[model samples]
Target: MEHSEHTEPRPPGLIGSVSGLVKTTLRLVMSRVELALAELSEVRDHLVKLAVLFALAILAAWFAIAFGTATLVFLVWETLGWKILLILAAVFAVLAFVLVKSAMKLIRGGFLGMPATLAEIKADRDMLL
Candidate 1:
């Protein structure tokens, strides 16, 4: 009779490998969620700052326009009469239109989306696929 003395370890079964894969996938999902949450917090902070700046800018601009228009009308009243006021109104309306259009363009540019989280998720998806 021949004697055999092999001491090799067996490979993991499908169930064990699948369980490990599930754990790793869950960990990946959790980490991605954390990243997205962190990015959202950053976006919130940025939005707060932008809102404050926008409010202050609007206040200052209104004050400047009010005082400057009063001074301009006062200075030009002798020559142009009430026509200067009409002209200034038209100019202000045009300027307001332009500013609104610019704001809309900026908003449509996706300035607040979580770009890093999206890219990472896409990369992970591509690797999996």
Candidate 2:
């Protein structure tokens, strides 16, 4: 048999490889973006929960403070005379401030830093192929 030197055509060069890599990267990024969006949704939900809880806690605290202050004023007026009402009011005001400040700090440190987004993303990623 006669031998003929022939070479099959090879694939395209660097540009083809780069394009394939880019397409793969884009697919990965799209999947990741979808995951991040899902996470954002969960974060939004948690934010709503936090807002509602914070509002309820603040309202309850305010009611408690108001009732306590009224009781203190009434007691001071009856027992210690009207002069002590002002001192009682001042103490109540300080307590209210402290309570509000501490509550705000706790809310900020706990619910606000809950990382719902990160957790959701991780969970979703784990569920992925």
Which candidate achieves the best TM-score against the true structure? 1
Q: After superposing candidate 2 on the true structure, give the runs of residues whose Cα lies further than 4 Å from its correct spot.
A: 1-12, 78-129
Best lDDT goes to which candidate?
1
Q: What 10-residue stretch in candidate 2 is worst by lDDT? A: 110-119
The residue pairs found clashing in candidate 2 are: none
Mind sharing the TM-score for model 2?
0.58
lDDT of 1 at 24: 97
Candidate 1 residues lying further than 4 Å off, grouped into runs, are 1-11, 101-111
Tens digit of lDDT per residue, candidate 2, span 47-118?
Answer: 898789879988998898779877777766777787677787688689879978987887677554536556
Backbone N/Cα/C clashes per model: 0, 0
Q: Give the TM-score of candidate 1.
A: 0.77
Backbone clashes in candidate 2 total 0
- Model 1, 70-122: lDDT tens digits are 99999999999999999999999999999899888877787688899999999
Which clashing pairs does model 1 show? none
